[model samples]
Target: MNGNDQVSRCGYVAIVGRPNVGKSTLLNRILGQKISITSKKPQTTRHQVLGIHTEGATQAIYVDTPGIHLAQGDRNKAINRYMNDAATSALRDVDLVVFIVDRTKWTEEDELVFQRIEHLKVPVILALNKVDWLDDKAELLPFIQKLAARRDFAEVIPISAIQGDQVSVLEQAVAQRLPESIHYFPDDQVTDRSQRFLAAELVREKIMRSLGNELPYQTTVEIEQFKYQGKTLHIHALILVEREGQKKIIIGEKGERIRQIGRDARVDMQDAFESKVMLNLWVKVKRGWSDDDRALKSLGFDDLG
Candidate 1:
């Protein structure tokens, strides 16, 4: 068929992996924009973020899900369960699956992710990410082979989500496999999430980055106000923690840490929204919110299975 008469193709593609395997990074790189937040910490992503990438005659809707983790002991909470449910739920009805693994390393979590998608009817592409961090390039083949044997993957490709290495090839593989259908989103739309959700995620990302090892997983951000006034966007975010001690850690001495988070988040907000941003942050102690099912549902974690 001629280029003008080429059939249009669009489909949902789920990017699944263990925590910190660069799922979010790959989605952002593919979309050429930051719809999903990334950090050094695992489980930084909690929601199923849909990044829509539309090219000529193709629209690949990528679902960037939270890492599917094994909840055990202290880690087993309502929030953790919610995250697992969110990740698995994305697999249902997807046309394709991109299962990402970090470099040559495969942990039990990776096995868990593999088990989840092993029985899938759709094509699952095994994306070995973070090859840029590999010290020995010769190990690539063996590692790829090892993972390729685990399942009948549609394709096994090496990638560096951070550096954009071989990502376009991956995108091409995804686009070619998309089933013929109508585009679900506008050509200009990059993500299905609203600005309010992105804003809250950005704030949570800043807190996770700023605190480093001290960061509490129980912390969540809620946008109390998100609206545009004249040429500027105003955001009021409340940071909820499980304990008073965690609240203090986020606040820091003289409230410097929270202010820093606000400043950093506002910059990202401005860049994301393409407008001036006025971000206000406040930390509150919501005891057992993370473990409480009702509290989690109230905080927008109601999308669980």
Candidate 2:
């Protein structure tokens, strides 16, 4: 075949791992833009985000999935179930799977992900993430050896998703394995998510990072209205909590807490949208909506699955 006719390589790639394993971070690094919202908190990404990368004729459609973890007690809520379902669903009918894990630590959740991928026929690449945090680089050899014994990975790559280390190598690895086909999306399009969805996610991310440990999981943001007027976007959002007390906590003593959340979210939204944002936020109590399937479906959680 001619060089121009032979360069085409396009396929689906799913990035899966336990919560806080830097799956979203790696996606942002690969695409070189923040389409998926991220926080230090586990389960920060509750939806399936599609990021597309094109180089020459290689077009890789990357699916950034929610971290899969063992669900129990309050963790057995519908939201968590949705996340697990979303992550698992991404694995089906994909040309490649990049299973991400931390540099030096492997938890039970990691094993859970391993079990899920064990039966998949697609090629699985084990990515040892967070190598930048390692104090002794020697530790990685044994870790890679140990993980390699668990499964027959197509390739094992060490990367620092935050530092952008070896990420291009990982991309090359992914691209080389993709089956040749036509580009699934336009070359310039970076992600499958729209600005409106990303705006809501940015708001949720601000709430997650701003509030202390407990509040993040108890909160979810819903975009009530998103409209563009001239050079500015007018956005109205609702911060949903399970109880009146939780709503009070989000609102803070003199509404300062919610104001800060709005401010932070607005700045990020402006950066993402590339325009001024007029954000209107309100705190509302939905009372156990997280555990209710119907409630979660209404809140747009079920669509991820």
Number of the predicted model whose TM-score against the real structure is largest: 1
- Tell me the tens digit of each residue's lDDT in model 2 across 1-305: 22677668899999999999999999999888889988898999999999999888899999999999999987898888999999999988899999999987989999999999998999999999998898999999988888788788999999999999999999999999999798989989999887878988998998888786656486888888999999889999998988888888788889998899999999988888889999999988888888888988898876653
The candidate 2 region of ten consecutive residues with least summed lDDT is 1-10
Candidate 1 weakest lDDT stretch, 10 residues: 1-10
Candidate 2: Cα lDDT at 158: 93
lDDT of 1 by residue, 18-66 (tens): 9999999999898888899999999999999999998888999999999
Q: List the residue pairs that clash in candidate 1.
A: none
Overall lDDT per candidate, in order of appearance? 0.92, 0.89
Q: How many clashes show up in model 2?
A: 0
Residue pairs in clash, model 2: none
> Which ranges in model 2 have alpha carbons more than 4 Å from their true place?
1-6
Candidate topping lDDT? 1
Off by over 4 Å in 1: 1-3
Provide the lDDT at 200 for model 1.
Answer: 97
TM-score of 2: 0.96
